[model samples]
Target: MTQTNRVSICHVAVGDLWAGAEVQLKVLLSKLVLRPDLNLSVILFNGGRLSEEIERLGIPVSVFPEDEWGSGKMLFELVRKFQRSDMKIIHTHKYKDTILAAPAAKLCGIPYVVRTVHGLREPFEGLEAFKMSLYESIERTVHRLCVNSIIGVSSQIERRYMAEGAVPRVVCIRNGIDLEKKPIQADRWLTRKELGVDAETCLIGTIGRLTPVKGLSYLLQAVPILLRQRANVRLLIVGDGVIRKDLEAQARDLGIGENVVFLGHREDTLELMQALDIFVLPSLSEGIPMALLEAMAASRAVVASRVGGIPEIVDDGVEGILVEPMDVTRLAESCLRLIDSPETAMKMGEQARKKVVQEFSATAMADRVAGLYKELVTSR
Candidate 1:
């Protein structure tokens, strides 16, 4: 059956704000669209920034601005689009998209449906947690019945999915970052000065949505200890969220307010990464964070919690130190170790950069996905 035709694929993603999963989807499109034998397009729910961003790249896009999600009309419309377009595979991201698109793909008679679990939302406490549990139950049921395969961004996530029996196949693909080949920007020095930090200050930073799952509270607790040891040390807390005020109050109470700068929701993330002396990730949970990958690619010494797929990238003492999650004392000790031993930190950073170059990259991830698509299509 060697029919000469391009296999069409739809990327179904429902996102309100652009973040990790959205960024990762963009990266995949940037590479996947280059395949001559495949036709790549994206399905954006609630058209706004994500839809506009993808369209700007010249990728085919279908924006559902008025479609009420999870409604019968929405599913019927999606199934019609798939059937009319003659799509072969449907790749979905996030819970809502997965739950909705799975049945749509099946109803449209699409040969295969695969999902990429970027990472589950950080389960909030109380009713929020219960809501997440109910959502997971629904998502799991759909995955087991409709989806053909599941791709996890980290081994930890893969294991979790397998344990839950979410799908027949769960694969670990690990999150990757696309490092620009350009030289480190010259404005890094100016960036530090603009942040109101001295030239000699050891700038430690982390970037992500300000959420409890990020374990930023622990980072704030460690700030006073870090300052006590090295008065010239400064912590740059990038991004903003519901906990921004609480985090600020904690920093002030710890008496390290001046030493910790709250840089709210920065768009110049790469430039900030280039300026950092050390990259710290004290997340209580994650699925191989792209921020950590980008920092490593920038050749900054990393100090991350030994949780999720972080260990798969950081390599303990080789590339960076891995401390227990929420262990403020150990987190502080890891940062101070890098600050004190500048030479060692430099060496570790160099190793981390080499690892990123050799393995974790957007191009590498795209290639793997293209191969998977070919494999699934061939089996059909």
Candidate 2:
């Protein structure tokens, strides 16, 4: 395709939070922009880490800060942007973005409007629960009226949407990360020293927002059990969220505060992954978690929950050990097993890294998405 004939596509999302969807979006666009037949741009509701990263990639990014403008004003501006740019495809992520941009894209006569279902919604209660329900309802209506395609990050997610009949077309495209940039290992020992952990200490780590859906409270409950068997073990809790204080309190209440360290949100996650002997993800739900993929990429043996897209990525005794989400006893047992059998853990970690390189590299994911864009353009 010639440069003038290249398809113009714009991605819209709420990019304030650097969570799973945001991370996936960043990787997708970073790789997608290299395609010769595609011209890409981004429109984010908030400008922070996500916008900065996309900008660093040399892509055109327009921020419509949620705080600066109301929804009506933003929609008007987005429609004008679409019309002026001659954008052929409008891809959106998150409920608010889809509800706002999908209809506007349809109004502009855009050839395709696509949205990715990153994962199942996190649980809420009381007034927040009601608000979430209302949002989902409006999102569904928008999908029916405007969206041409929906992308699910896992097969299970695709099946759920197919079953619910939320949209006319749905496709399963698993999430992936860049395999070329391996986790930094030169400072592995230095990082452990900085964390006050020695080589002999079995450093267990989990990375994610400290939210209820992460099932971190269960990880903490499992910690007391892990302590009963081993005294040299330490748990590293990375990332911060709404429930940070609650989780910290739970650790103290269980009398395992000294064994757990809350590192909060750190920019050096890849470096930190190399310092750990084992990686654990005890989430109540997930959708091809990027952290799990990164830990596996780092060649760290993992103990993760059997939920959402997790089982699709990990075999019970192969890449990592899988346990029931709330099974505190089993979670602790899995961790202890890996700690006691170093050779077995090392073998599993090696296999995990190989799996990512073979099946889940960011190049593979971007190719799939680009293929879809072409197919949709052809149909249009």
Candidate 3:
């Protein structure tokens, strides 16, 4: 379709928070709002901290109280909203949003209904997994039956969905970052000193919610090993969630609590990225973590698990080191390798930054998304 014939797009996101998906949504919406050729509106299942941020940036957002857990009055309300709007394309992000929005989009007779799968749902250690599996199965079925397009953040994610038989014209669109706006540089001494680290300390940092899926416990297990070999090593964890207290206790139990600093949630993530010597992501599963990209863009060496879309971004011995997920010993070894070889780490960081600048700029991502919308709407 020509730009003039494109339809207004309504994006349905799970919520407003500082997670990877939320940050991507905010960046994409901010870019789309400035384009006169596209009409966009974002619907959040619930609103929180990011609500004001989105509004402040002049993007239209509506909050619906329907929790993504089950079918209820909330689902009806969403359907009614779609029916009343002139939305030509309804794109859902995350599982719950896709499940709930698929039916509504079909009922409203919208020509294009797309779902972007960010991560694969997995079984939890306890009863939650049973419920999660059931819901995920239903969601997969809905995607198979209703959604027009299924977009994956990485080829790994696309393969996972295909394996589950939820294939629906899958497309790989890696997440992008804004490289023009450089990360804020903190006075390295001041930031580390505030965290009780000295000038000679080598700071290893990870930016993500303190959740089990992040495999933070595994990262903590590697800390004692790293510290025993290098006393100057310190860990700086940024972000908070339901698992904060558990992670804190785990760090203490490992006898390395004093060497670890929990910065909680912060608005100055880029500045935090600047203060770090190395970035680590030990997630057991992920879909192209934006934090890793942002850290690499800041020219920081990364030590991330070899899972999901991480390998797509960081080549195993090139831009960063990729260790097996949950291998505390290997994880620690990778961090140590980076620390011992500062010059090599710096070289990798430089290469990682160049890769991000060349391939993952936010403007490039937005243009591709807009182009996809044009293709879908024009075909109809």
The top-ranked prediction according to lDDT is 2
Model 1 agreement with the true structure over 137-182: per-residue lDDT tens digits: 8887898889988899988888888898867778888767776446
Worst-scoring 10-residue span by lDDT in model 1: 64-73
lDDT of each: 0.86, 0.92, 0.85
Which order, best to worst by TM-score? 2, 1, 3
Which of 1 and 2 is ahead in lDDT? 2
- For the record, the alpha-carbon RMSD of candidate 3 to the native fold, in angstroms, is 2.3
User: lDDT of model 1 at residue 165?
Assistant: 81
CA lDDT, candidate 2, residue 312 = 90
Clashing pairs in 1: none
Pick the winner on TM-score between candidates 1 and 3. 1
Candidate 3 lDDT over 51-160, as tens digits, reads 66688777688888665534576678788988898888898898778888888888888888888877766438678988897887888788877887777889987786
Q: Tell me the TM-score of model 1.
A: 0.95
For model 3 the TM-score comes to 0.94
